[model samples]
Structures are given as C-alpha cells and as structure tokens.
Target: MTSSPDTQPIVVGIDPDPTQWLALAWAVDEATRRRLPLRLAHAREAPPSKYRTAELTPAWETWDEALRTLGTRALEQVEAFVRDRRPEVEVSVLLVEGDAASVLRGQA
Candidate 1:
C-alpha cells in the first residue's frame, strides 16, 4: 500500500554547488520508488553586518534581498532538475532561512 500524504517526507538538501545535484537525483529516484513526496530544501545564512542593531539599514535590506534571491534560484534549479528526471513524483520546494544543519534537523 502507498503511504498517506501525512507520512514522513523524503527530504533532499540542495545548494548552488553542483555536487549537491547528485544527492538530489538519488533522493528523487528513492522517493519515486517508494511513492513518497519529496521536499527539496535550501538553507541560507545571513551575512554579518555592522548595522545589525540599527533596525534595518539599506545595506542590510539589500543583503537580505540578495540572500532571498539566491535561495529562490537554488530551489528553482533543483525543482527543474527533479521534474526532468522524475516527472511523476510529487515534489515541494522549501527555502529555509537558517544554517543547513539546523534547518534539516528541525525538519527531522
């Protein structure tokens, strides 16, 4: 019997580095075989700033926007990669705002 939608998800950590693509591909195949939903996650850490205590300076805002854009692009790339390789598998994208290990641990 297939697992229900509320079952534990098959999570794949993705990044801008090409090496992570291999892990994603493998996860996609496993998820498809198991008939489980795939969650593609990309975590981004904020950069250090001198105005961090300034309550939102223009520089901080710009940096934040850049980080968000990077996360978006990474997720989109992985989503496309998964779709091309395993179109039948259910997939979801997660753009997390924190360190990779912490984000993954929280998901677990």
Candidate 2:
C-alpha cells in the first residue's frame, strides 16, 4: 500500500554539491520501491557578519537572502532530478536555515 505524506516519509539530507547526489538517488529508489513520499531537506547557515568600525558591509538581510537563494536552487535541482527519475514518487522540498546536521536531525 502507498503511504501518505503524513506517514513516515523517506527523508534525505540534500547536499549542495552536485557531485554528491548519489545518496539522493538511493533515497529516491528506496522511496519509490517502498511507495513512500520523499522529503528533500536542504539546510543553509549564513556566515557571521563581522562588525567593522569603518568598513561598508551589506546588511544582515542580504546575507540571509543570498543563503536562502542558494539553498532554494540546490533543492530545486535535486527535486527536479528525483521527479525526472521517478515521476510516480511524491517529492517534497524543505528549505531550512540552520546547520545541516541539526536541521536534518529535526527532519527525522
């Protein structure tokens, strides 16, 4: 029987590195075989802004927006891959702000 989205989804921590999509491929295969939904989670943490007494620097919002943009791109890329590979499988994306490990742990 197929599982619903509310059921235990096959969670995979998506890597920003395109070369490291093997894990995501495996997760998609497993989720497809098990007839479960796939949750692709991408986590990004912005660098700490250094306060310079007399230097012009972008605002915190800039940094946050950049991180979110990159994270969203990464998730979209993988989500497309998974969908193309297995159109029958339900795919979901999660763009989160935090350390990868901590955010993925919360996904579990």
Best by TM-score: 1
Q: Could you tell me the TM-score of candidate 2?
A: 0.83
How do the residues 1-108 of candidate 2 rate in per-residue lDDT, one tens digit apiece? 357546888899998788999999999999988999989998887554465223434566676788899889999899989988999888889998788898888988
Estimate the TM-score for candidate 1.
Answer: 0.86
lDDT per residue (tens digit) for residues 48-88 in model 1 = 55658677777788988899998899888889888899888
Off by over 4 Å in 2: 48-57
Top lDDT model: 2
lDDT scores in order: 0.83, 0.84
